[model samples]
Target: MNLKGKTILITGGASGIGLESAKQFLALGANVIITGRNKEKLDQAKKLYPQLTAIQNDVSNPDDALKLYHIAESLGGIDILYNNAGVSNPTNNLAKANDKITEMAAYEMDINYISVVRLNNLFLKMLQNRPEAAIINTTSILSYVPSNLAPTYSATKAALRFYTASLRNHLEVAKSNIKVFELLPPLVATEMAKGIDAKTITPETLVKALLDGIQKNKFTIRVGDTKVVYFLSRFFPKTAYKLINPVKNSIKLSA
Candidate 1:
């Protein structure tokens, strides 16, 4: 889709991939609005990119989500809602019966999965009113193969992957103008992936690929290693699983 003059709202835009996305989107002539829970990070982003409208918002909270809708409405609404906010708890021993396991899973699910649905529902009507609009949900390569070190995070992405597909199909059947796009990215050099020992892509490279996909109307945009995993997961499930969880890097968290 043509991004020039379009208004885009990106979640978790304070740093990493979100911040990079905001920069690139702005350079493309799109009016960019970004949201994050930390006021300091939001302020930093605004200072760095004076053109960005950075708002403090926690996507997991229902009230904050509604408030964000109103705030975006005040800015005359947005043409694209980029659900890029996500979280992953530190590696835990899932084999052990730890109370924190459930808590961590719930936290990841809320931000990484549920929040995407909530934001999409909140913006659905507004998006429909626009001449041309789109929803971008960031899933991950782990959605195709579970990461032993990040089980809950993998599950959340998997759930989102299915939801995004269903949402896109539903909109099409209803003859809606709003387009739904699912972005499956591989390990990227971001704050979230700091401790992981893996090959990584720069946020700039990832966002560039994303914009290209959006322009070409590629509904399922898989970048870098994600494309290889997607193919292997379909034809060589075992190899795909092993590729994500290499034996040498395996950590035994439980007896």
Candidate 2:
């Protein structure tokens, strides 16, 4: 769809892929609003792009999403909802860290999976008021297979993939103009992927791919390792899961 004169909202858009997308969209003459949990970061982004609207909203919080929806409505309604907020950690060897697993499950599930769903529901009303609308889910290459560094993060992305397909199919069956989009990115060199030697998917390449896909009407757009990981996971579900999910042995038992 045409980005010009459109109003777009991106979660976790203060930095990383979301930030790059905001910059691109703004350049295309779209009114971009980026939401984040950090006030300082939001202020910094506003300083950089005087035209951009930066809102402080924690996607992981349901109440915050509701509040944000209202705020977005006041800003001429939302034409696009980019569900991009997420977090990850290195879990190559998590051993017996129940605390860590618990934390990861809560944070990852909320930020990655639950928040997306909430925004979709909250914004659908506003989006329907528009001539056309789109929902962009920021899934990852790890959504198909497990990630060596983050088990929970991968699982949540996988869940999001399934949800995105289901939601799109439902909307299509109902004959709605509201489109569902999935953006699966490969491991990119960012603060999130620091110290990792995995090939980085450049932000520019990613945003370009997304725009190209949207123009071509491609819904499930996976760049770089996304297709490979998803294929491996689908064809070799058991093995891929095992590989991604490292063994968590009890040291007491070994002793």
Candidate 3:
């Protein structure tokens, strides 16, 4: 959990939480490789942090994840995998729900859910070669409490939460040294939540807590006010949905 000399791989590392964590990981003296879909943004990030190595890859694609693993193996097998890439499609009230609407949600599932499965498989073998390994799955506060605004996104993360737990149980049964972590991110002020006024947590704060959470063996790390949502939903699952529906409808309205 110290992660001082570990090799790490992260998706969507060009911006937001992914980029912030990359910066922190580099400062901690770890070998880090970041992946992003935007060539221009990746170049900008590289210029900002010349010590960082970046690859242009989208995690939503299994093929891309395979290619990324191949690229990493060529360098060195990663000790940590950060599944941070995700997407949130704008809501629409159209009767058809068209491909465009579903496309982004599907992208979210690919990155938020499927990419972890793919990378874990590719690196699980290599990780088993080592005595210790870690898998950090970036879920959201809405994972437990569905967000109507991000219908598909929330469902996928919820599914990922269960998947993370199951994977951990299996790892325990297998007596593997790998650690599985679930990150329930709140409305951080990252570019992804730029317009929101939810008192975003600084990148430094989030990463510091994240690394600390890993060291403390925290299975689920809910940052900031997100912790409230997690517990409330657990106790009043039905009422939580009723509250979220109105907010989501408002977002759809604005859209």
Candidate 4:
């Protein structure tokens, strides 16, 4: 998709991957609106990239999502919706026998999975009206291989991945011009991923790859080692789980 002159809305765009992506989109001649729950972070992002239109929004809230949609609509509707808002509690503990689900886990599913669905549905019609449009959802490498350290996060992403695929299929069957793209990034060096020490890609690198993927019309864009994760999951799911689960186990042991 040609990003030039398009309006793009990104959730959690105050920092990390979302911030970098907003910068890139602005650089590519797109009008970018970034939303986050934190006002300080939004201000910080705006200070860095004065071109960005920062909106204080919590995607997990349906009301906030509706407000966001109306805000974008006032700008003549968004050409791209980047669903990137997410949380991760990268704790060392894994679920034990008969352990009940925690509040944090439930919150993860609400924000990561439910919010994405809500926002996508809210913006689908607006996107279809545009000459060219896209919905980019950020699902992680853990979407395929469960992370022992962040079990809830992994499960939420996995659910998101499945939903994204189904949404793509639905759009295709309807012959819609709107494109659906999924970004799978592996171990990005971000504040959200601080505790897990691993070889990581910078947010800038991931955003660059994402822009290129969009131009090439790659439906599922896997950045860095995520491509390997996708391949492993497709061919050797057991091996993929074994390979990733140990990293957290080793970290737990060391701690």
Candidate 5:
């Protein structure tokens, strides 16, 4: 719960939300380690924050995931695991996909869904042994309402949302101190949301909301417009779907 002195590991810490989180956590007196696929980016982050421990590990790779776990263990184990590594590839038709589209979709699943599960399972015991610990999964508003622009991304996040909910329930039943928090962010100004022309929040704003949510003991933290999206999807599924993918909805309506 307390950020001070906590050892936190953030996947995809090279840039975007993960990087911002690492920066804030370090400022809060936490020992932060960030994992990424880019060595240059990792080096750059280390330069910015000399206190940070940057590990070049791609979560999508099983070998890399194991390596990350061992590395974290060697760092005296982490108090928090931020499952923040993910990808989004815009695809018009999920089913009618070319090899490239299919590959991209598969890669999205591997990074977004599979990696989260692997890292959590690998680190669950270590977290449980700690006095206080947390697992933060960076899901998206598209977890509930489908995003036409990124069908695979939406589906994987939806899967993660469910899994995270289940994990929370399991931890509660087991009376474990390890907390599971789902961070659902709306369209944010990040590389992942590059082509998406919508009302987007900055990474700093999202990180502030995230820390606030964590402090309040909120398990499901929806930032900015994501809360509205979650509300609409909860009560008005069709309208939420239409709002997120107006063109497809209009085509369906016309048919």
Candidate 6:
């Protein structure tokens, strides 16, 4: 759980929450390596944080994932693999007959859920060998209550939520030194959340809570509205559903 002197590899680290996490992790005296699909953004991130090791990688690509592992290995391997890359297609899935619905859903699933599993499987052995290591998976508040406007995205996060929990339990049962941490964040004020009229928390605030949770050995790190939604979703499922999909935000499906 101790981040100091540890090497952490964060996916989608060019901007938003990932970039903020890299900045904060560096401040904690940890070696931070970031990967993203955009080469320009990666360069910019490197320019901003000279200490960051930014690499161009698409988490959805299996080849890139393998290449990333080799690159990390060359850099002495990573103690923390932060699966922070995710995509949300805000198009209402049931609104109309869209030919690309399956494609969009698949894309979100690959990056948000499948890629996490891939990265975990790739680095699990390395993490187990370390004295202290962790895998951080970023799920959303939508995992607790589905969002009608972003149904596919919600489903992906929900799937990731279950996967993270199962992985954590599996590791514990096997007496593995690798720690699995699930970060459930509410609507964050990032480029991804733009145009979504909802109360949001800054990336700095969310990552701060995440780091605090990791240090405290809290496996499930829920931030801001996520905590309230978690509680409500358990006892007041209807209210939780309403909160996530208000009347104004509900979609009307075509007949």
Give all candidates' CA lDDT scores: 0.94, 0.82, 0.80, 0.89, 0.89, 0.93
lDDT tens digits by residue: candidate 6, 1-255: 789999999999999999999999999999999999999999999999999999999988999999999999999999999999999886665757788899889999999999999999999998999999999999999999998888999999999999999999999999999899999999999999998888999999999999999999999999999999999999999999999888767533322
Tens-digit lDDT track for model 1 on 112-229? 9999999999999999999999999999999999998899999999999999999999999999999999999999999899978889999999999999999999999999999999
Query: TM-score for model 5?
Result: 0.94
lDDT of 4 by residue, 98-147 (tens): 34457778888999999999999999999999999999999999998987
Q: Write the per-residue lDDT of candidate 5 for residues 92-118, one digit (tens) a residue.
A: 464453668778878889999999999
* lDDT ranking, best first: 1, 6, 4, 5, 2, 3
lDDT digits (tens) for residues 1-255 of candidate 2:
777888889999898888888998988888999999899988988988899899998887888889998899787798988888888866534555466667768887888898899889988878877898899998888777766557678889889999999999998998888889999998876789887545688888999899888767899899976776677787988876654444532222233
Which ten contiguous residues of candidate 3 have the minimum total lDDT?
Answer: 88-97
User: Candidate 3 or 4, higher lDDT?
Assistant: 4
Q: What is every candidate's alpha-carbon RMSD to the true fold?
A: 1.0, 3.4, 2.4, 1.9, 2.4, 1.4
**Candidate 4 overall lDDT versus native:** 0.89
What RMSD value applies to candidate 1?
1.0
The list of candidate 3 runs beyond 4 A from truth reads 92-99, 197-199, 242-255
- Mark the regions of model 2 whose C-alpha exceeds 4 Å error after superposition: 92-97, 234-255
State which candidate, 4 or 6, has the greater TM-score.
6
- Against the correct fold, how does model 2 do in TM-score? 0.89
Candidate 6 off by > 4 Å: 251-255
Model 2, residue 29: distance off in Å is 1.5
Model 3 lDDT per residue over 1-255, tens place: 778889888888998888889998888888888999999989999999998899999776778878888898889778888888877665544454476876676677776788778877878888877767889988887787776556787888888889989998999899998999988887677776754434577767887788879878897898976777777788987876665565646665566
